[model samples]
Target: MCLLNLIVRLSYVDHTQDVSHTGRVVELKNYVRGLLLDSSGPLTKVELINHLQRLGVGYLFEEEIRTVLDAIWKGKDIEIENDLHATALRFRILRQNGYDASIDYFNSFIDEMGSFKACLCEDTKGLLSLYEASYLAFPGETRMDEAKAFAKRHLKDRKGKIDTRFEEQVDHAFELPIHYRMLRLEARWYIDMCEKDETMDPVILELAKLDYNILQASYQKDVQNGSFPTMYYRWWRQLGLVEKLPFIRDRWLECYLFSLSITYEPQYGYGREVLNKVNQMITLLDDTYDVYGTVEELELFTDAIDRWDTSAIKQLPEYMRTSFLALLNFGNDLGYDTLKDQGWDVIPCVGKLDEIARGDVPKSIQCYMHEANVSEAIAREHIRGIIDETWKEMNKEYVTDHVFPRAFADAAVGLAQRAECVYVNGDGFGRNQSNSEINGQVMSLVVEPIPINNV
Candidate 1:
């Protein structure tokens, strides 16, 4: 599915003072800044930098982190790296941050048979670091390819054999690499993970908890009042799609999550709201086209969308009429705001990823199932294989291509990553989408505030 991009350019929340905790947060920020700027060793520095990022406060110290990583990348080739963990961590931080780190650094760990040194496998921490670093590989990087397979095979063999913290990490890496997780959600999970680590700085954990809760409060205010999406749910209720149509999922919260995942930085508040609206309308369109409409009715609906006018309203079915008018009003509202605020006129749109019922074309999984006459399991595997292959291509292209604005390219690629995270288990946007895993994820990231007293 294509991404919904709405840009009204604004500030991200990094500079927004969480007023209640202003003194405490400022104290923590300066303390952490000292830790970064202090003369820490390579291992400690990377660990601190990574903790800053996973804690969701890295953006506040971007210049510091950049200066640190830059010095690390350009310095003595990390000649002081004493083990696989340090080597892999250094390699990943450098390459991942757009430095031209050489793959040859891994050569020392490889033997004549092209396999990693067998002794290295016993170092679970090193293996995990290698596993994570391998994700930075561009296409044809055979060393990284081998590193991933080798590390994954051993990590599976050693699952419960590791410490609690590393074991939890290994389990999650298998479920979905940290590379592919939605950032805010991962930050939430990582806060708890760090809390359990004995070596984790209590100050950092405090900042993480307070920062996450503050951001969650801001996001919830933007999305809803409490458990319900009251902000624009009223606007949606006024449209009466859920009441009149009954088939479409009431997914205002999910749409907001999708928008938030796409543009999580606080500065993109306007863009996020606009994108949220675009996602909701697209969901309505997706449900209308995929689940309810007949081919002939869909033809009329598509035509109405194509015509993009008020008169086309009379042609749609009664339920479809409500959704169509909502779409038009959405466009008109966006156009009005953009014109009034920025002197530019624009409308919004989206694409569907699932099947279009019995009459229209089948999606990838459906086609696989129909062709192979296999169970849904087989079909899903085939489809995921396709997604994985395409991910590699996307991975390669993003690594090698440097022609566009990095932030824009990052957001473009992030849409695919975010979509994968959403549908990892199944249809995350389905009507009955309240599974515990998904719901807990939603609560942890965008809903429930972390109880800061313990941390």
Candidate 2:
């Protein structure tokens, strides 16, 4: 007879008698067996307890269930799945008669133990030892070792004697997660600033906003595809906005490394190599701007820096300070190099062509005329001087009369056209189009006009 049938039979001694505590024990065994059989595979201890509670089983003690499970699994009447850290057991009734008989006998032995821990205590360690064991069981999951190293610098507690396991767990959890979280928050702040800053150009701000949204969407897709954990993906998606904000890209990379340094031990050679590459990129960007960018470009750069303005330097976080200082030094070095390269001379002014043509009836605007086509250096120099002088006298009045009014009229016409397009596309007037289809159509209309004389 099978062990389950034997137990069921044993539960009722006389055929007419009332069912006793043995029947209750038999019922408990049957309950566990039924749950395991119904499951696709093995169940965790916690899952098994939850299953029993849900089934309305009375007098169900975790310890008692654990004891029965262990015995049934050991006798090969139940198969135990090998997990990463422990065995997750499942019952299979129709395996072997001898196995069933052995399990039935072992079940009685377990019952004599008075409680589940009487058997469990023989194999497992005490609370503190179990805490250490938990860390050892999954080294990747618990960064307690890293936390210990970090705490050592601040704590008076001696090595190997500090009772800060629980504290370390909590701290490590947030420490590893918070850096990326802050990066995301800061990225969002920069994106919002682009939209709201009065000094910022609308076109540039709109581009930054688009870049922010694209990176965020890509990060989220990667997370959903399981390339990273949801927590890491969510944090990284926020940080992805950093790339869209001017001057924050390098700072974001530094923050990324700072966070990594806590969870991962830096191998000296590899770590140094990566840091050197990052420094080189920063140097390259500095050189590119110094050699190529105009004063107007520098003004934009300065504005970006000023957006994060703070009175006290110490108020910035340590990692942020490190990143900002690196960028600041790069900008300062570039400024000095640019000044030296230009022989400390001021940038030459380009004057108004219309004003120059007003005083001297030149065939065409001298400023618009290319220097390359000028036959002699003397002629080029004379033309440039006349343009500058004429600009100093009448450039402001000419701009007020011609340029400002024309620009306002053109802008008004463009806005009206855009409004019509929006209305035709079933969108409200003045509502900014986000999709590429509408933006592309609007951009098509912004093409430079060909000369009417050529047409």
> TM-score of every model?
0.86, 0.15
lDDT tens readout by residue for model 2, 328-421: 4434544465478765522111011112212323333343355445544556557544533442233223223454553343323223333333
Cα lDDT of candidate 1 equals 0.74
- Total backbone clashes of candidate 2, pairs 3 or more residues apart or in separate chains: 0
- Lowest summed lDDT across 10 adjacent residues in model 1 is found at 1-10
Q: Tell me the spans in candidate 1 whose CA falls farther than 4 Å from its real position.
A: 1-20, 78-82, 223-229, 348-361, 372-375, 397-404, 431-433
The TM-score measured for candidate 2 stands at 0.15
lDDT of 1 by residue, 113-173 (tens): 8889998878898889899888777656878878999999988888778787789899888
lDDT of each: 0.74, 0.32
